[model samples]
Structures are given as C-alpha cells and as structure tokens.
Target: MHISAREREIINLLLDHPDGINVQEIAESLNVSSRTVQRELKGVESIASAHSLFLKKVLGVGMYIEGTPEQKNELQIAILKSGQEFTQKERQELILCSLLKEPESIKLSSLANDLHVTVATVSNDLNKVEEWLKDFDLNLIRKKGYGIALLGSERKKRKALGHLIAQQLNEYEFLSVVEDEYESKTRFSNGLLEIIKLEKLTMIGKMIRDIEQQLPYSLADSAFMTFTIHLSLAIERIIQGEVIQIDQEVLEELSISKEFIIASQIVIELEEVFQVNIPIAEKGYITMHLLGARQRQEKNDWQKESSTEMVVGSKKLINYVSKELEINFEEDQALFEGLITHIEPAIYRIQKKLDANNPLAGQIQEDYPAMFKIIQEGLSEAFPKIVFPTEEIAYLVLHFGSSQVIYDNSKEVRALVLCSSGIGSSKMLASRIKKEIKEITEIEVSSLANLRNIQIDQYDIILSTVEMPGFSKKYITVNPLLPKKEAEQIRDEIKRNSLTTEATLLRKLHNKKFKKQIKLKTPKLIKQNLEVIQQYTETVLHILNTFETISLPFIPTSSILLLEVCKQANVRGLIGDYFEVTNQLTEREKKGGLGIPGTSIALYHCRSEYVMQPVFLSFLLHEPMVVKAMDHSSIKINTLLLLLAPVDMQTGQLEVLSTISSTIIDDEESTRIFTSNNYTDIYSKLSYALYDNLQKRFKD
Candidate 1:
C-alpha cells in the first residue's frame, strides 16, 4: 500500500494520462534520465500490480492501464487490503471487474481476446468467480458464441462489488507507508516488510500515509529507518507509561537535518494530541519516519513541510545563536539546538577550549589569564576564582587536592593496591608501602573480588600480596609483612622502569678546544698595542659574556661567526652601535622582523697571545646601515679601520693612537671624544655606562 515519492509521481502521471506516458516523455518532463524514468516506472508497476491493478508495458512506448472510475477505485481499495490471500489470477480478476461494468456478462471469446488471454482461461476465471459468489444467487451463463455471463440483478451485483472494494480498501489503508522497497532499501534490507515488525513504525507509517500519502526524496531512506527504530522503542515505553533511557549515540548518529526537524515537530504535535511524554530521542525518530512516509506519498510535500513553521522555541533559539556567533542561520533551530542542548556536552566543549588555551594564558597576566578572559566574556557575570562546571571542578579537586606521591620528575602516578580481603591488615600494608615507597603517586586498596572488575589500564602499577591471574604482568608481588629489603628493591625497580627515553639518550660532547692558527709578519713586541686593543675589545667581550651560557641546542653557526667578529672589533665608545646591531639580529632571528641590519664594527686588534707578532684587526662597515641585511641582493663591505698592536707587553703598558684622516667625519660622539683634552675621561664614561647596563639587563 505504501508508495515511494518517485513511484507516486509516476502513478499520478499514469492516472492523469490514461493513454499512457512514455519513459522518454516522463524523463524529459521530470528532468531526469530516461533510465531513471524507466526504473521509477518499474517500481510503480510492481506496487500497482501488488495492489491488484494491472499495468501493461508497451515495448517501444511506455506503460498503460485502462480502467473506469469504479474499477480504478476498486483497484485502489484492493491494494490497501490485508492478508496474503489474494493470488495473481484473483488480482487480475479483481482488476477486470473494477475496469468493466458487466465483466461476467461479456462473451468469453471476446472478453478473453480483449484481456489478451485464452477463452479457456476466462472460462476457468468465471467458474472461480461463480463459486466465490455462490451465496449471492449468481450463476455463470454460457452462450453458444458469446462469453459466459453472471445472471444476477444489477443492483445486487453493484452492492456486492462495493462491499468487496470497501473490504480491500479498509485492509489496504492499514498497510505501513515505509513498507515499500524504495523507502526502506537504505534502512533495512527487506524494506518496509522488516520495519512493520516494530509496532510504532507500523503506526507512524499509517499516520503519515493518511496525512500525506508519501514521503520526500531528499530525506534518505536510512534516516527513515533510524527514526523508526528510535520511535518504536520510545513509543512502546510511552504507551506502558514508563520512562526510557534513550541512547545518546543514536541521537548523534541521526544528525539533525531539515526533514528531521520537521518530523520532530510533527511528533511533538502528535504527542500533544495523544497526551504522551515521549523522550527526545524517540521524538526524533518519529519525525524522520513521518517525513519519509510523507515524502513517499508526495515528493513536493517535503518542500512545503520544510517551509512551514514547526517549533517556535527552536527557531527563536537558532536566531539567537546566529546573532551571537555572527554566522548566518541556514538550518532549522531543532537541528542546531539538539547539538548543544545537553549541559554536559556544552560544558565539555568549554572545558576543552579552556585546557587548550591554559598554558599560554597561564603565563600571561598570571595563571589561566586567557581562559579567565574567555569565561568572563563568554559566560556572562558568573566569575569565580576557580570557575568550572560541577563535574569538571570535582575532577580538578580530586586530582589536585590530595597529598599524592610525586615522582623525581614531579609527575603524579595514580596506582592500585591489589590485596586479599583483610581490612586491618590491608590498611596497615598500604600505610607501610606508602612510607617505604617515597614516590607512590596514589594507592587504591581493594580486595580481589572488587579489583577483578576494575579497569587496570589507568593505574600506573599494582602492588599485591596475593597472586592474581591476568593481572600478574602489571602487578608487583610483595609480602604483607612489609619487609624493608623487599620494599627497597621494588622502589628501585619502579624508579628504573619509570626513566624516560629522553633521559637515557646520552649526548657525545667533545670538550678539548681547538686553537686557531695565526700567521704574523711583525717581529716587535705588540704587548702595549694589544693592551690598547683589549680596552676597546672590552665592549664586545662584555656583550658576549652577558650571554655566556645557552641551554637549548644548535645556536646558528652564522650567529657564532658574527659574535667572533664583534669580539675582535672591541672599539671604545662603540658599545651603543654594537648593542643596537645585536638586539636587531636577535629580534630578527626570533620573530622574523626587519632583518639584521647591514653593519660593521671597527676593531682595533691588539697583540697576539702566544706568538711574537704584530696584529692589526679591522672590520669594514657594511652600508645603508639601518637597512635589513637580509634584503640585499648581495652583501658588500668596502671601508675598513685597522688597529696596530704589539705582540707582547709588560705590566701597566698603554698604547694611544691619534686620528690621521684629512676628511673629518662629522661624528657627534667621536667629534666630542677627539676634541676633548682628556681621552681617558671620554672613554671611561662610555665604558662604565655600557658595562653597568649590560650587567643589570643582559646578565639577568
């Protein structure tokens, strides 16, 4: 009795065009493929024939069936009838009776020819019909050339036919709308036949058929089946007046869609009409079933239902949410509301977001700053110092409040105590073990009976006096008397086992420093000259000394080379210039800012440490000094300042030099230092300030 959306559409086409509509025309009109039209028509044929309505296919054309109004009505009624008692022949006979006014009175040869059958077949059909109507005083009349006729009053015959039609329709009306193959194929293998077993599904399908006649195509068949399963279970509970535990997984899997929402609204309305308190999960299922059934009756009905206002509160909630999230509202509120209606689920999402932002937020503006801000802004005015949902807060307290054991790494490990049933002895054993094992994270004491069912995967380790099967691999056996030697061994084993792989990886570091080879040309002692260079070099050395130790691996080889160059420069009164360069380089390396500027340091090189040689260290300044060095197509340095120093020096030796350049560089600080009467005074002030600031800021 149940018809799919496409099947119903095809039937409607057939009913409107009694002359018959070809597959090509149907396909073209529906904007579907010819193959699709063919499939749809075939389904219609099966359903039509199942209901005792003859649908004859024309080879090069389409499908057709001719019937008077009475006959069509009768066929429609017969299709709705219950019981598997109607045979193919009986069905054909019913169709014929519905199609013809005086089927029994028609000549056998002519009637058989019109029906495309043999006279003998018609004669046999007449005989069966006569036997079926024996109580009505009807006899089969056979003429020499004409077909057999039923000799009965026209009024009596009409009454009998009407009664048969009503009986068939009454049974047909009760057939489940979801029983059809097209609607049930995705949900159940056997389709509607399998679904009918669920009492609620049967009722829901009937209700849908009576209301709309068919379901929509957009609502997939699987969705309908899922709805049936949930609704049926819920309806049964509701009828029995018992509260039911709805499965959360089922609701999630259903996935709220437009059809589902509409279906849910229908279910709610139905519940109001029936005065029942159906669970939300069950209501969802009923809605799907109804939508699917309605779709099967009329494909366009889905569009109408989708546009209709179903639930006001849900719609308002969706609108409110859309305003809050700044997202366009496209789906129905029912679908969206179903997602966040549960308090636990909503809280879980909030908690996850909090945890994800905890570390970064914790560092800024004290602990959990970002989390605090989000909670304050997002959750209105309920701001507690430790604000969290009840369950989450409880978990936090349980985790942090107790005086749990801490490992050497400061990690907490919750453990389980596997012991035999001896309350006093078990308590004493736990206390002793806790005292013996300095790093016991947690100790849960339980008897074997209770411990067997407990999930052991969560526990770090198990300590037991008794041997337990299945858990022997995870548990460490200990004597209940708490021997000191045994406890020490166990603790040592636990510590050894707990050592992480990262801790075990030994780094092979070479400590023997290699000295760089130097080639010198001068034979004079450059000690006094080197001492002068050392004073200038102090600025670079101070900066290097500030970052004396680095913990993280792999400082760039380029950075080390730059540091070496700065160390050799050691120019007096150039501390500010060097500080700026170093700061820029570090920032560029960290945040990829305006890259390291093209810069140069004038290093007055001093005397060599071991070799008897003269040394002059000079570095050319790279240009557009403030321009990021990384932006240059190529690095070029043309100017240089070289320093001359002695190879060796006695104690308290000093080397002083005067500028010889003809072109006076209009340098502010340099001009002041060069024009000053006392050079020591000028150098001392710059050196003191640079050293003081470097010590205070960079050192820390």
Candidate 2:
C-alpha cells in the first residue's frame, strides 16, 4: 500500500494517541487548519483499511484506532520501512505525461498496473487529467473496452507537453536536466523522462547555447530553457515518425523574416545532429516560437521595439486605465516600458494560439477582482481584435499593479531579484520588496541565465521568483505578487540576518573607541527619532480627525447623491472644487462598481489634485440607493464611504488611506460598524487600526 507523507504523519500521530483525539487537537498538532485535517482524514481512513484496522468515532469523544496491538505494530513497521511514494497529484501528472507522449490508445488496466493502483483509482485520476488537458484545448477520449486516447492538434499536443514539463520541474530542476544532470529523473518516475531522452536534452541545450550569440537579442533564462525543451521534444517526436504540419501561407510569409532564417539554421543543425530529415513546416513552427520568445532588454529599451502598433496599443491601455481609475499614469514611463515589453510578445502568443500559463492567475484574480475586471475592459478597448486569456490578463495586471504606487525609503541593504524572465513578475516582486521592507536599499533584477555572472558579494541578499537547484548561496524564494504571509516571512528572515550581522560587528568593535563614538551620536539620534515619531503621530491624528459620519437627506438618484457628498467636502475645505471632484468620482463610477459586496455600503475612492489631503468620510443616506457592486452585481446601499487622497501624496499617508480601504471590508465586525453608520464605533475601529500600523512603523 502507498501512503503520502502527510498520511504517514497523521497515522503516526494516531498511533501515539491510542486514546481518542479530537479534530482540533490533530489540527493544532499538525499546524494545519481544521479543514485540512478533515480533508486528510478521508485519505487516512484508506491507510487504516489497508492495515486491517479501523478508525472508531464516538459522539463528543473524537477518533481513535480500533485494532490489536500486533496489527498496529505491523502497520508502524511498514510505514517506517516504506520509501517515499507517488502522491496523488504526482500520479496524475505521470498519467498526463504518458497520454501526451502516446500516439495510440492506452488501456486503463495498463495504466493501473504501471501506477501500482487500482483501475478505479486510475479512472478517477483520468477525470482530473481530462480537465487539465482542456486548458490546452486537448480532449481525452475514453471508451468502455477500447481503452483511452488523447486527441488534439499536433501544435496543441506539443504545447500541452511543454507545459506539463514546465509545471513538473522548477527552473533549477529544469536547468539541471539541460545540463545533463538527470537528477530530476530520480524523482519524476519513468513516464515523463521517457518523453525525451537525457542525451537529447543535453545536445539541444548545447546547440542552443552555441547559437545564442547569433540571435539579435539574448533570450531570457525562461525562454531559453523553454525553447531548448521544445526542440528536444520535437526531435523525439520526429524520430518516432510523428510529423507535424503548418499552414503554407503562414510559412511563406514567415520565410522572409529574420527569425525564419535563424529557425532554418537551427533545423539544419538539428538534422545533422539527429540524422533525421527535417521538414519545412518544422521551421515555420520554430519561427513562431522565436517570434513569441521573450528577449532580455534594458529597462528603458521599450522604445527600441520596431512595432509601432504595440507602442500605440500600450499607450491606449494606460490611458484607458488612467481615465477609469481617475489616476494619472500617462507619465509613468516605467509602466509604459513594462507594458510594451509584455504586450508585444503577448499579442504574438495570442495570435499563435500559445498557452501563456500563469500560476498566479487565481491569486491575482482573487486579490484584485476590481482591478482585474478593469484591465480586462481596458484590453478590449486597446486591442479590439485580440482576445487575451485570463493568464495573460493576470500578467498585465501585475505590470499595472506594480506601477500604481511608488515607494521611497532609506534602505541600506542591497538585494537582487532573480526571476524566470526579468519582466512582469520580476518588476512586481522588486517593487513589493522595496515597498514593504525598509531595510532593502536597492533592488536589481536579473534573469536566471545571468545568475552565474552576478557579483554575489555586492548584494546583501538574493531573492528569486523561481526555485534555484544546485545553488550553494542563500536565497529566499518568493512569489511574484508577494502575498502578505510571504512578506512577513521575508521581513522575519531579513531581521534575523540583520541581527546576525550586527552581532558580529558589535563583537569586532568591542572597544573603548567604538563605545565613545556611539555615545557621541546619542543625542542627535534621539532628536531625529523624536521628529519621526512626531510626524507619524501628526499624520495619524489628521487622518482620524478627517474621518466623519454625516447623515444626508433623502437623494432620489445616485448622481445627485454623489454631488451632495462632493459639496459637503467642498464646504468643509476637503476639496477646492466640488464640481470637478464630482466629475472625477462620476467617471470612476462609470468604469467599475464601488459598492462593497455582502453589505449595504458603497465605497467611492479617488486620487485627485482637487483634494487637499487624505480624507475618509462616511455618509448615511435616508433612503438606500441602488449601485453596482464590486462583482458587477446590483446592490442596495445605505452608506457611502468616501476615501480621498491628494494626487501627490507621501507613501506613509497613502498607506494609512489604503488601510482604511482594507478595514472597510476587513471582517464582519468592522464592516458591520461601517454599515451601521455609527460615528463612535467607526472612530474606535479606525483608531485601533491606525494604532496598530503606527506601532509597526515606530517599533524601533
């Protein structure tokens, strides 16, 4: 019997506690949620059955193992002697690897036997595998007795194959294979490795490296590795007599391009090395890959691109998003450049029907649904003829999201950001690290290909978006978007390292001269610290004082209600002109919904030159008004939370205003207080929230 690592750990816990243990106790012990423990229990039950034992549950008592001591000991011994087995997810991937590589129908029983699982288990795995294939536009064909086959165009089949390999191996592992390490094969099992022989991978890698200098621009590490694997797989398929075809018209058009010439050269070399007759159509596909490949360019090199349409499209996108959000990004040059770099290849990928997979798509969508929708709308308006997938849209969101704010801090430590391609994710990750971590003074981004050439001692720390295999130096692997949990983790790690460095320095300076130097600067440091604290306190007070709840008379329409709020702000000197601010707010509303979902409140927020400072005001309506919710659904709202900030504001002030936005939808209690339209309750909530933030900023 095969059991996962988590299942073994769970069984061990149950064995230790022969007595009943509640689900909560199990969850606490494992450092997992109750839901995670509950989900694992279903798998745990199967292990118990295999060991001739049963789990006993009693009302209000919890669960315990019911079996003889001998049976328990035998099961424990088996677990101790057992090696790591294939997880259900790994098994499913192996199944996909087999199906994508196989050109003929494969039997269900054959798959079951190879995986050391039952036919029923394989069938269940196939159900999930089918859904995964659908993302590549491939279909799984299963018959009762005739067996199963995967049906798709050769182009899609190859796309699916490449994605599977990319998904299975991290950058480090992928590079290891290309370097002829073959270490990945030890863990990946036979099916995936059988797709391309190790020797072929090494040869392809060497050939690509030899020809790297011939190209007009250098390929990013991700693009280089992807192209290498693609060529290796194409050679393998060609050897097996699986020929692919390309459109003649497209081929004829591509033949005159520079990429086509390079593609032809690559095919000639491959034909010589593999001793196979390469077809003209193969060169056409290679040209497409080359056309869509991401090339490493300087940060300001976006203007160098030959495509004028791409530059115009990028400007239109930025203008659309700027108008909709009521923020000025027309002059954000970094944003314009990043969009040019991302959108150019994005358009080619879409035109070629390529799968631009984004692992962070779900997280990005969940975290910023409003921004996601806005970007989606902007894409439609900017590139009307092209239909971008969610994956590509998510990547574009990262580019815009990163450019939304700017952070300036007095950082002392230098860090390097190593991403797959130094493009969308790298820019976002670097921005987030600098924004959140004050100690990080400077950030430099590099592709994985440049890792070897980087001066390690120049950087105090190394941060990577992908895993680095065979790397001896210390590096923290972080997600591109920098989720909250990972941000905290990065903070803790930086702190720990800082303490170590400081301790060493203190030891080295354990003398009278060092002590005298520190004492000399004590008064100056104290005065500087006092000023910072006073500024923080003043900012906090200003934000809290500006926060107010006003009860407005009945307004029959949304537009009139907005004007009333703007007029109130103008009368209170919050804004210089109510008409201009109202116009800005109206434009924002037309772009997307501002209503908070699952509540009777709407949040109208904007950054405008008309606003004097950051303001958080609540307006209670005598009658509920119908508005659009964040999810694009109609909602009835009785409260309006107007959050405003100056067009040019300090990062600290922006943070406080952003905090208010978070607090409105933070949880049930805070949302309830805002929705209740109670002045004292809301004031207390903001006070507590700001207090917590102030503590972090002034923790020194």
Candidate 3:
C-alpha cells in the first residue's frame, strides 16, 4: 500500500522506539495535530499487522510497536524494499539538480514526469526550492516559453552549484582513465558531464599543476579538487553564453595584480586547449581564486621583508585571536611570521573581489565555530578594508589551526594537589581545576599524610586543601570540591614562569557591570520589596515541585515530547493568561534547530507574549530523540532544556539565565541533572551548580 513519506517516517520512528508514544507527542514531532497522528496511526496499524507487527496503544500512555526483534527487522526490510513514494526532500534535490545542470528550462510536467509526481506536487516542490535559492541570492525564473530557469550572476550560480554539489557530490559518478590497472572510482552524472566534458575537467586539472609549477603556490588536496569543479562549472556557464561580471574598478585593480597576471596566462593556454574565447572578466574571477587559494609552506618567506602594513595587520589579528580564546600566542614568533605571510596575499584577495569559494567552509565552520567567529571579528578590525566572506575567513582559519601551541591542553606547570577529603572530593577538585585553569601538565591528588613520605623537589607547585608545614615548593590553598580562588593562583603562577610577564589587556573582559545596591527609605517600601522577592522565591519553589520534570519514557519525536512538556507548563501555571507556550515553541523551532553543535543537549527558549515570568524547565528522557539542532544537524537529544522568559524581560535578567544555562552545557556538574532520575537529586545538584556558576561569574 502507498504511504505518504511522513507516515513512513512515523512508522520508522515508532520502530526505533519500541516503547509506546502518545498521539500528542507524535503530532508534535510530525508538525501535525494530535487528530492527524491518530488518523495516521490507524492507517499505520493495519500496515504494521500485515507485516506481523502490532501498533499497541495504551489508554493513559501511548502507542508502541509489539513484535519480536526479528519480525521488526523484517518489517524494516519490507518498508525499504517497497518502492517508497517520492519524499518532498528527495524531490527538492532532483529539482535543484535539474535546474542547475540542465541547459534548458525545466517544464513543470517534465519535472513531474521524472519524479513520478503530479504537476501540483512539482509546483509545491519548486516553492520550497525558490525559498532555499533566495539564501544563495538566486531566483527561479518561470515564464510561458521558458518554463523555468535559475537566474543569477555566473559567480553566484557557480557558488550555488558548488554548495549543491558538495552536499550531493558523492551521488555523481566519477570516471578516471589513469594508466595501467588504477583509475579514479569517483563518478559524475551525464548532466554534469554536459556542463564540462570529462576531458575538459582533466585539462583544467593539468592547467592548475602547470600554474603551481610556475608560481610559488599550491592548493590543498581537498582545495584543488573543489577548485577543479568550480572552474569546470565556470567553463560550463561561459560556454552557455554567460560570463562573470566583475566591477570595472575591481577589474582594473586585479588586471595589474600578480594573481590576475597568472590568470591571464592560464586563460591563454585554456583558449588554445578548449578552442573557446574566454572573457577577461572570467580571467579576473580565476585570479581571485588563485589569490585566496592556500599557499604551499615549502616556500618559507617569513624571514623575507614584509611591508609594514602587512606585519602590523598580522600582529593585530593574532592579538585579537589570543585575547578572545584566552591563550597567549604573541611569544610564538613562528606563528606571528606565518600570519604575516598569509595576510599579505589575503589582503589583495579581499580588496579585489566579492566571492572566493572555500568548498570546505561548511566542515571548517562546524569544527572550529568558536575560532571562526573570533577570527571573523578579528579580521574586521585588522583589515578594516574589505568585508570578508565566511568562506574566505575559513581559509585563514587553516593557518591558526596548524599552530599547536595555541590550543595545547597540557599546562607547563607541574603540581600535586593534596586534600583532606577522600578521592571523591579530590577528583572533583581536579576536574574543576582542569575546567577553569586549562593548565597543569601533571596533577596527582593525594591525602596529606601520604605527602609526608613523598619528595617535595619533584613538583614545582603544590595545591593543598589543608596547611602543609615547611613545604619547599610554592604551596597554594584551594577548595577540595572546586578551587575558584586557586584558579587565579594557577594563572598568576603560570605567568611568573614566562620570560616576559606581560598580561593580556582583554583578560578582564569577562566582568559584568556591577549592580547598584537598593536601600529602602520607608518601612512600607521595604515591605513591598520583601513581598516581591518572597513571591518570586515561592514561584520558583512551586515550579520545581509542580513540574520537577518527567523523564521521557520513550524516544518520541521532538514535537510529541514538546506537547507533553507544554501540558505540564500549562497545568503548573507556567504559561501566562490566554497563552499556550507550545504554539510559540512550534513557531520558534521552524526558524532553526533548537540544539547547539558539538553538544548532545537541545535548548528551546523564547521571550513570548505567552510568558508571565521567566521560567526554566529541564526535561530528561530515557533515550535520545533524533532532533534537528541549531546547526541544521540531526542529533540525538537525551536532555531538553526549555527557557520561556517574560515578553519584556530586562536585558540583565535574561543574561543571568543565559549565563547559568551556558555553565550547565559547558561543565559536567550541572549536566548530570539532565540524566538524573531522582527529583531531590536533580534539584539539589542543579541549584548548587547554578550557585557555583554564579560565583565563578562574579570572580570573573
């Protein structure tokens, strides 16, 4: 029987979660109503029973699949074996490929025929495609004679094509005719081949090798492959009578630049090989790629005299990065010179162009997002000349990423930590130190009595919870659980070891503005303030007791779990008058993934008209829900933290909550609460963790 993609997805979801799920939960996950889930479940139950599986429903709980593991596998195989209907996502991909690769306008009927879908369905798919294209500054042009074509500058089209290709490049067939028994297994489609013949692509590859031999430059292996595809797409577009349009002034500037000179010579060879007239603008476009392209390190010119402007720019950028990351790099002369060499050519690349593609930009952003943002902001100050695309900034990140000293976790300081408490508190102390200090080459925890027999000269620094008499080493007292004061001591001691004892100017940037003390003059005014404080305290207590959080029993869709949480929020009076928090949550999730990258947790928060006071709710689940996060990646979320603030919450009030949440995500202490089953355990641990985080913020 034919089933919609959504139903198939729901069935698969149910299969993944053998434990029953509620209709309300399924509805939320599918972005449908509970009624819709019930209707679909009825249809799915028949399909399940046909495959010897059952969709069992409990009155108070939800629906679950009841079948043996072997039967479930069979059900999955059957589902996969059946010719599943075209999902909207797959249709969109097909639509994008056809528009980009095909030279002719794609008729609505033609697209529908290829996808085996109706014209209206194709139309709906295009609507989604059109919205997606807008992000790339591309437009879908639909007309009577010309059915539909992608309208944009050749540059943008190439970038869009590269992005699309990057996402689905694995799907294309790649052929290689390497001499004798070895060939490239990669594949490209006939449509892609039409854009640039396989021979032409091979030719461009050769041209780049020849160029590299002449110039003191070579692209990274990944960068070279990406460049070949980009050039091929450019050639394809040029052959189709579309030429790159560069601004007249930028063209004049680039024509005299070194990159443009090399591009012109390459274009000369290209014309002879392809028997096609290449545009000067196209040559200029190629020049931008050559300029921004990764340079080979074999040509070490750090000692070579750099212009004053380049050196100064490099220094500023490096300093900015060091300050933001809270790591010292100024002493690393090698890194300083390397930045100078990189910035010299990069400045030119930025000055002369708007777009320079870095194909690995997506992966880079995902891996070093924190570094990317810091460098992005740093470039703005250091260069101040041109706006840097996130792509260009990503290439620059390669230079910093290569430097090991900047992010090295092993602190140069060797020390022994002694605590009166047993291993548990001592272990917690070491963890806290590691989290805060980021320094400590070797830290061994020991009881004070054991230290009497140990040699003191072996260690340079000593951290003790109890007083140690006549210790030759520099001894510092610290907390057994968390060494808040001892962290500052560690930093100060580490700085003393450095040859030059200068500190970073931005070290104090963490400090928030101090609040003014509020003193009441009148007795009545004091009583009012006390009552207000008492009410909020009572409110928090009420929330904690009323909606401590239900550890989700099964893996449900994000929407389904969301409904369950919203029901609690409403019942507990967390929702404001005439407001349903779930409605705002559904709307917010549509904007992007609610989870942050590199973290397993997901956060759903908003300041809505539906909120009275800021309420923070943490939900635990037995299994991780496969949900889309802020980075547009699907991650298994075991814990869900919900933050609903007042519609007009004060900026400072919101920041306090945000800071507390960040601490929980950043440190493991509070994160344990998300997985905890005991209500008292969770409450005590979270409250204490929040207090510790606030204390650290004050210290900062």
Q: Pick the candidate with the highest lDDT.
A: 2
Candidate 2 has its poorest 10 consecutive residues by lDDT at: 499-508
Candidate 2 error regions (>4 Å): 1-85, 180-189, 294-301, 304-306, 323-327, 357-370, 404-700
Reference-based TM-score of each model: 0.17, 0.50, 0.46
**Model 3, which residues run further than 4 Å from truth?**
1-90, 101-105, 142-147, 166-199, 245-265, 294-300, 303-305, 363-369, 396-402, 409-700
Candidate with better lDDT, 2 vs 3: 2
Model 1's TM-score against the true structure: 0.17
Expressed as tens digits, the lDDT of each residue in 1-700 for candidate 3 is 6666777768867875566666655665566665666667777888889988888887434688898877777776666556667567767877887887665687888888878899899988899999989978989998876699998766777777776654533212221321112132122333344455666666787777768777766675545555676777777777778777778886887788787888889888878877789988888778777766656475466545578877888889989987776667777787887777666666665564434545568767765555677789998898897677776788777777656554352235556777442222244456566667766656666655456766554454667654433343446655443435547756776755432111111111222111122232477756664564455445445445544665667745777788777776777787764236676677667654566445566777655677776676677877777887544568777777776666554433433444444444445655565545457866776566545644564464
Model 1 lDDT on a 0 to 1 scale: 0.41
Model 2 TM-score on a 0 to 1 scale: 0.50
Better of 1 and 3 by lDDT: 3
User: Cα RMSD (Å) per model?
Assistant: 33.6, 21.8, 17.5
Candidates ranked by TM-score, best first?
A: 2, 3, 1
Q: Count the backbone clashes (under 3 Å) in each candidate.
A: 32, 0, 13
| Model 2: per-residue Cα lDDT at residue 237 | 88
Across 304-402, the per-residue lDDT of candidate 2 in tens digits comes to 754888888899999987766545678788888888888888788789875665545776776556567778999999999999898789988778766
Cα deviation in Å at residue 462, candidate 3? 30
Which lDDT tens digits does candidate 1 get at residues 260-284?
Answer: 6665666776587557876675554
Q: Give the better candidate number (1 or 3) by TM-score.
A: 3
